[model samples]
Target: MKRVMGCHLEIEVIDPTEVELQVAVSGAWDDGQVVESLRCTLDGRAVDVREVRDPAGARIHVLDAGPGRLVVDYDAEVTGRARPATGTAHERSLYLRPSRYAEADKFFGFAATEFADVVEEHGDDAAVLLPYVAAWVGSRLDYVPGASGPTDSAKDTLLAGAGVCRDYSHLTVALLRALGVPARLAAVYAPGCDPMDFHAVAEALVGDTWHVADATCLAPRSSLVRIATGRDAADTAFCDNHGGGIQLHVSQVHAIVDGPLPGDDLAELVAIT
Candidate 1:
């Protein structure tokens, strides 16, 4: 499958600051299936964006830009059947614990009741719990754009019972972690996403592979292009600045697939490539 995606941002930096853009596709792209036509610029000029790759190969572009109006534009075409990862215990210890937004520990009681009987009946399988958690979260929440805040945790989302993609992902990750499954948040470029923009989904470890559990089900999980993955949104924000203030004048993102979107099967264990 082929996918095209990009984002445009206009920001007024009040002071000198360190900025990082986690908007590029993962650096683990297969060499043979190369269709990666990508570019990033500031004020129509090429900016020095250094590449940083995590242990898992997600890409983060970092640059120190000025106290001026910076227009950052990026676009890329990803062409390949994404490579599959063999699951390992290396990241399990980190993902199983509660983080800033996930707060898995806070949701343990709610999780016990939600999956208690199901676990007894199905024998505590991640494959079974994955889809069940996704469906449960989907049923509880409404897809309201402004219903959640940046600082909101899984507890906050559960109380509100309404949120966008990231919120749903946060809650799903927390709940799965509470149920003893190592799960984390992934920021991806989702082709065929409704109200298209960068999307976030919950990814859980089941046996020897990482499977996506998108409660929102906004796009086909198999078509998702990985941007960044972490404990939660904090580690995968599209734009983050360390110092000074930045005013976002304009922000836009678009993504689409080459042909018609593939049908999404929540029951299937699909990994985000």
Candidate 2:
């Protein structure tokens, strides 16, 4: 089996003040493998870790916070999980809650319009629709790391035609939802990636299960790792409620698989500075 890993960061601070925070880390991997376990530390203090598994992928979240300089460390090893055949309608429709879809006035206009068209054009088949959208977004946008924020909307990305993974995933989710597909964003640490590292991806409910797809990875088939998922990047953010200012520094390491190595397995890492 092949493996990939990396890390990322998202920090914002305005000055001196107390902050509340919660962070989640996610990635994708070959299914049917056992994720040995994961350990995470925040601000030099150990945080609580939670695990959740779904058809789309497996995820781990670190919930904790303190004062200035938030530091984090995490490691997990996942084995392959069984996957069901594709081409089935999603059992449920994801309802967009008012509170969840905040800042509608800004996101609903052009962003929603363009996304709706894309979905409508490819609604008939998942195989065709999924990759088409993924490639379209990845190819159309330039990966400009450190130039976007959590609140950046689909319109912002569409206008600039360049952004980080969060922007890419957000735009993808918006478009998927507009086309009547239940879609969400995932925050993950890629173990071996670098530069444009720690990443986010988009997932849409197709057939009876959720299928993972990232425009950034150009529709990561079964190769990419799995992490956490939420309605958008905000829901699956790496850090919790932090009020003061935020700063992020992320790194990754990708290696050709030869055998098991000690320490961390996933390439994605997230750090708040």
TM-score of 2: 0.63
Instruction: Tell me the whole-model lDDT of each prediction, alpha carbons only.
Output: 0.85, 0.50
- What is the lDDT, from 0 to 100, of the residue 224 in candidate 2? 41
Over 121-231, each residue of candidate 1 has an lDDT whose tens digit, in order, gives: 886588999899999999999999999988998899999999999999999999999999999999998988888888999999988788888899899888888888899
User: Which number leads on lDDT?
Assistant: 1
Best by TM-score: 1
**Over 4 Å off in model 2, which ranges?**
2-70, 82-91, 95-124, 189-196, 218-220, 242-273
Q: Which 10 residues in a row give candidate 1 its minimum summed lDDT?
A: 33-42
Q: Compute each candidate's TM-score over C-alphas.
A: 0.95, 0.63
In terms of lDDT, model 1 sits at 0.85
